[model samples]
Target: MDTLQFLIDGFAVALAPQNLMFALFGAFIGTLIGALPGLGPANGVAILIPLAFTLGLPADTAMILLTAVYAGAMYGGRISSILLNIPGDEPAMMTCLDGYPMAQKGKAAEALALSAVASFMGGLIGTIGLILLAPVLAKFALTFGPAEYFALFMLAFATLGGITGKNPMKTVVAATLGIMISTVGIDNTGVQRYTFGILKLYEGVDFILAIVGLFAISELLLFIEERAGAGRKLIQVGKLLLRPRDILHVLPTTLRGGSLGFIAGVLPGAGASLGSFISYTLEKQYLGKKGHFGEGDPRGVAAPEAGNNGASSGALVPMLTLGVPGSGTTAVLLAMLISLNITPGPLMFTQNADIVWGVIAALLIGNLLLLVLNIPLVGFFVKLLSVPPMFLLPMVTMIAFVGIYSISHSTFDLYFMIGFGVAGYLLRKLEMPLVPIILGLLLGPEMEKNLGHALVISDGDWSVLWGTPLAASLWLVAGLGLILPYIVGPILRRRMRAAITEDAVSD
Candidate 1:
């Protein structure tokens, strides 16, 4: 098939001596951060952005390194979640649901093994999905017009309510602020809008600066809050154990989880946390009354692991095919790609085949590396849980600021980065999802340019927005994306709380 040939060609590119080393270095660093609590794939990628650019490497090598890091970290997150009962990020949350319990039962090794296998299965499934879906999806993506993109932007904005559980109204407000921040640079006519008479503001806000502030520095302030009271328990753990029965037991769960996760991740704004939830629900349905889900079922461990990992790969599809990032990590990656002068879309398939398929091949390698490293060296991975956030946060913040400065050696960008970090931190404390901000920033310019083009095509007519069925359908879906969160969020929260209380009482 075409996929096999692409992989074959990708190998020739990925196996080059320089690229192979990059892959290893990325996997190593990725594993370190992925095992650290609160430092998920997104933060890791963002923190390392400086390293990626400073080397001035070829784009394919850079993509290979970053993708491997991403792939490795997806599996690396499981180590802390299973051993320490602390999830490294949102995706690993479900792993803690059952994995932590299993650790308590002194089967930490078994739980670790199961997670490793499930991660591999999920990763492979996700990779297959990326290869098969990107081209076809790119064709579909080619149909999006400015109006459709604008509607998509609105839908992306609305997801703040559905994901950020602490305060929906605050999330919406924060997202609106982000949209406003994006609007400050220039209007559709390339004329400046919100510069406020400042000469430096002419070029607008740097998204890299904003992301660094939101993810890195803001987190630094949060870390300071828990500096002295950090509650970490060191584990003198034993070796991981694996058996054929454990493998067989989880195969069904992994397959089911991968399929569901891939589908869920494809939908705009839905991410690994949602994918894990969906997989857990589906597994419970299949289990009916037979499986003891929350009470440390091995299958319970497999479902979320597979789902989140599958979803991680699934997120890449949208970013590569449509230049739309469905999750925060992809948003960062999408920006990185754009900065590298790579445009992701239908043309990318024809033009950047090596970067595309090379990334795919690197992920496969990272998955294998994760599986090999996670099981036999369980003690090594568990020790990653001991890394302190206070130490880690500062380094990440430093990297973010430095990386922005190094890009073009701009002091104004450094100031903007810190400023954004402060604002981002405030939003984080408010529990407003930062993802909508990234999504809005990524698609906003495209929407503006396309809308202008559509008007020009239609001779300045407003009717172009709803003229085509494809555009009309996207608009309708986008509207639903905005509304579904508001309508379903409150009801779902109440029911979920009730269930959690019941489970806590039963436990």
Candidate 2:
């Protein structure tokens, strides 16, 4: 009953004219970015961060805009996968297996419309799951002490390697670098560790500058290097319409995939990519060749579309209740919340209920908007593939420079941002995953604080780290998180790669 009232209050906040306008604008831009192969949701949100700040949106409103963008990007990723053989992002790769084939078969419109509906189903399910689960998790989190929190942080780092990248060692290196970076500012005891006499160093590297540099600026550098969209022709999107029978056929698959994706999203370290892959793989297995699982099957298009979108929603759960991001984009969103001076986790629900519920309501609204917009504007979005990188890169660069400059009016930050961008490009070139670095930066200080509190209570006893049952359980899970990747990752990767390879040969 209380949840019902809170939801009503949330809708009141989200329905404001300004919030609605920003939501629509964000949805539009998000789809545009996502349709361009390689940008995905993380880049979409990071690129637009400065816009939110420059506009000086309140916490809830800013969240609403970004969340709308996030959802739109998930929906838009399918556009490229269906029309062009290239996937718009990693999660969209599964869509390409069937979507591209369908386009070749002249069912491009059917594939696009069906996938949009599936995405809507997944996103809607995920939002409802968020509304139900976040509060319960937050309430449970209230029982946690410093030791439990420290253990939780360790669990996040341990599990992240498996989810975010192919190699754990590289993830460890990146995370260590981030932690080292976090130690730059003054310590709680008032002594500076790595300031090196620079005044700005006292405050440490700003999260906004780091995120913008790593995601937005780094992306620009890569775009310039690849000379993106040199000569890609879009497949014709014939008659944007879906038959009733097609929608009915995929409804069960959409439901199952959405449910699975939501579960994957709720699990720490299991993100949208995993959600989509596992959903498609399992559904294919369940149907066992009779369903035409690979050769332009509508089920293939629907399953992954539902899974990834559901996972996108599911990722928000941990960020809201536990202050740990479930995926890369959510990591960026977590940084946004922190920058706004809003701490996530248990207290967030009570202290910032308006923000939490308002964002939730906005997600519901955004998904509906995406469903309405995707079918009609998909042809327009497909045309975006032909847009030259030269034109787009400069605009993105200008936004980053102008927006960062507006915030601090400091040339040093601009220089620092450029340096981070260069470093990010180098890191990407080396195949070092960037998400772990961002997570480390975001979680390092909190983990340190919790460790400090626990040590103080235990009077310098190391055993306190695993003394309690709850803390010990978390440590056990962290251990499994580190080990299971070696055992389970290989099989999953092999199967997914084999599927893609088979599809390529069939094509």
lDDT of each: 0.76, 0.91
Q: Which stretches of candidate 1 lie over 4 Å from their true place?
A: 144-155, 158-168, 186-190, 196-199, 227-231, 487-503
CA displacement after TM-score superposition, residue 300 of candidate 1 (Å) = 1.0
User: Highest lDDT: which candidate?
Assistant: 2
Error of 1 at 241 (Å): 2.0
Model 2: CA > 4 A from native: 229-231
RMSD of each: 2.5, 1.1
lDDT by residue (tens digit), candidate 1, 176-262: 676677677767577888898887777667676777677767766776775535547854466667889879988999999998888
| Candidate 2 residue lDDT tens string, 44-99 | 99988988988889998999999999999999999989998888898999999899
What clash pairs does model 2 have?
Answer: none
User: By TM-score, how accurate is candidate 1?
Assistant: 0.92
